[model samples]
Target: MRIYPIETGNFKLDGGAMFGVVPKVIWQRTNPADVNNLIDIAARCLLLEDGNRLILIDSGLGNKQSDKFFGYYYRWGDHTLDGSLAKLGFHRDDITDVFMTHLHFDHCGGSIQWNKDRTGYEPAFKNAAFWTNENHWQWATHPNAREKASFLKENLLPMQESGQLRFIQRGDTSFLEKSELGFDILFVDGHSEKQMIPHIRYKGKTLVFMADLIPTVGHIPLPYVMGYDTRPLLTLAEKELFLNTAVQNEFYLLFEHDAHNELCTLQHTAKGVRLKNTHNFDEIFS
Candidate 1:
């Protein structure tokens, strides 16, 4: 099995919102903010190749949003999902499965695109079966006001219309049962209802896709939750529980929003817990 890091794009977000109640003095060091107090973040996605299946995890924010809408985030980056796929000798059509961690625009927007002539939306990966949990789907479709903006309809309706949308049943980890690169799906609702993070066991090491649950290494501290989360207190509990398990199992965390750091290991520290070490993806895998 082979794994590839697919960088879709980069965008800036309010650093304070990203770090929640964490003081600027603390988070600014790891993720320094711009003069506008925004930080650049990567919409990093993962591609897994196992035998005949080429699966993609989370599509980045697509380029379909209006300029006015995108201007807020200040999207910047030469790397695009299409370009990255082409670099790997693959294309959208090559993807057999698209495992979305959640339906947030930054994470799932690239899953659909404007069709030719710009009449309506269409599946970005027409050949792939879009995977998301049934509960998460309902929650996103009928989103609460807090998360409504992040769950755009243009990015989601296309999949259901394409007839490629499939909801994984709760506790069903057999999504990749036939593949050598099978993953253990870990669901947590603190960030959003039933968000699935894939834990892949490869080469005697476990690599976990740290979605919004742990957006960056700086979020290792228990209380450093994101302001965007619907339930901040629930996030604290979920993060603490997950971090404990991650440290105990020595799992490698793959960050989705961290622009500089791709992966890191956690260890117990006098101040609760902190990053034990940090490394690039290729460096560790190589």
Candidate 2:
């Protein structure tokens, strides 16, 4: 089996919002912000290649939102999902599975796109099955007011409408062993209800996809949580447990939103679980 980091696109988000309750004086040392108070963010997806299946972990924000809508985010990049796929000699059609870590717009927006002639929406990966758990599907569809804006309808619905949407069978435990998509899943509810973090076994190493749970290396600290989260206290507990487990298992974390630091390892420090090392995707897997 092989894995590749698919950099779909890059955008900027308010640093204050990204680092919740943390002072700019502290977070700026790790994730420095611009004069506009925005920091660079990447919609870095992951692709898994094993025999006949080409599974994409998450699809970044697509090019379907209105210009006015996008202007708010300040997206600045030359990277396109198609170009990234082409570099690896693959196409959207080649993806057999589009496994979503969650249904947030920035995470799953690329899964749907406008049809020809600017008609209604359609699945971007026409041949792939869109994956999300039953709990998340319901939460996103009938979103609470706090997360409603992030859970855009256009980014969703198409997969379900196309009859290609699928859900992983999750038990009551926080972790599910051997999910249908050929990986273990950790269900954390702090970021969003039942956010599935994939534990992929590749090349004698376990890579954990740090979706919103630990978006960037800056978030390695237990207290550095995102302001967007619904339950910060729950996040504090979940993050502490996950970080400790990650350090114990020597897991390589794959950051979905971190533009500078793609992958990192953790070690026990005097303070707590801290970053041990950072690596390029190819430095290890290649």
Candidate 3:
């Protein structure tokens, strides 16, 4: 099996929102903010190539939104989803599965695109089955007021409309063991309802796709949770449990929202689990 890092692009978000109640004095040290008090964020996706299946985890924000809509996010850089795929000698059609960690726009917006006629939306990965859990599917489709803005209809409806949408059946256990994609799903509800974090066993190491649960290295601390989360207290507990397990198992965390750092391992520190080492995709695998 081979894993590739697909960088869609970078965008800026309010540092305050990203780090919740954590003071700017603390978080700014690791994730320095710009003059506008916004921090850089990457829509970093992962591509898993195993035998006949090429599974993509999380499609970044696509370029379908209006200029006015995009202006709010302050997107930067030359990277794009199609361009990244082409660099790896692959195309959208080569993807057999799109495993979405959640349905937030930045994470799954690239799942759909405007058709040739620009009349309506169409699946971005024409040949891939778009994957999301049943609980998340319902929560996203009928979003609450707080998360409604992040779950855009344009990013979701196309997959369902194209008849390519699929759900990973949840079980009584914490990890779903029967995914055909060859990864264990870790469900956490703090960030959103039933957010599935993929625990992939690759090359003698367990590489976890750390979606929004642990977005960046700066978010390693238990108290440093995102303000966007519906239940901040729940997030604290979830992070603590997940981090302890990650440290014990020596898992390589594949970050989705960190711009500078791609992968990291944990070490038990006086302050609890902290980042041990940072690495790029190639460096870790090589």
Candidate 4:
């Protein structure tokens, strides 16, 4: 199976929100903030060419949102989801499955688009089956007050309305050994309800799509939880277990929100699990 990194776009977010209670004096060492106190973020998605099934994980924020709405995020960069796909000699119509880690605007917003005449919304990947766990589907559709802003209806309903929405039947456990997409999934709840972290076995290595569980190398320290997480305490425990397991298993973590670092591996450190090495996708895969 061949896998490709699809860079959707780049944007800046408040460093304080990204690092939660972690002091700026500390997080700044790893993720330095700009003069505006915002740090760079990338919507890096993953594409897998496994046989005939061209699967994409985490579509980045699409361009359908109004300028006013996008101004809040302070977008930057020339990369785009469409351009990235074209670079790989593929297109949105070529995607057979779209595996969403969660329904946050920045993560799944690219799944829908404004139809002709802008009268209504439609599935961005018309031929692709939008995949998400049933539990998360419900949670996202009926979002709570704290998360309501992140779960936009324009980013969701269209998938279901297009009758292309599919759910991975999960057992009563935090980890699913195999999903319908032929990859393992680690369910995390601290960030959001039932956030699915994909563990793809490829090229004799396990490349894990870190998603919101461990967004960046800066977030590896466990206590550096994002303020956006609903259950910070649960996040601490989940991160501890996942980080330890990642080090023991020697998994390669692919970051979705980290603008600079592409991938990293962890090791048991004096201060618990810490980054062992950083690698460019082609550098290690080559």
Each model's C-alpha lDDT? 0.92, 0.91, 0.91, 0.91
- Residue-level lDDT tens digits of model 1 in 131-240: 99999999999999999999999988889989999999988868988777658998899899999999998888899999899999888999999999988999999889
In angstroms, give how far residue 181 of model 4 lies from its true place: 9.1
Candidate 3 overall lDDT versus native: 0.91
Give the per-residue lDDT digits (tens) of candidate 3, residues 1-286. Answer: 6888899999999999999999999999999999999999999999988778888999999989999999999999999998999998999999999999999999999999999999999998899999998999999999999999999999988889899999887753322234334478888999999998988887788999999999999999999999999989999999999999999999999999999999999999998999999998888786
Local distance difference test, candidate 2: 0.91
Best by lDDT: 1
Residue by residue across 69-103, what tens digits does model 2's lDDT show? 89999998788899999999999999999999999
What are the RMSD figures for all models against the true structure? 0.9, 2.4, 2.1, 2.4
Model 1 segments beyond 4 Å from truth?
A: none
| Better structure of 1 and 4 per TM-score | 1
lDDT of 4 by residue, 190-282 (tens): 999999998877777889999999888899997999999999999999999999899888999999999999999999978899999999999
| Deviation from native of the Cα of residue 114 in model 4, angstroms | 0.2
Give per-residue lDDT, candidate 3, residue 141.
Answer: 97
| Candidate that would win on TM-score | 1
Best of the two (1, 3) by TM-score: 1
Off by more than 4 A, model 2: 171-182
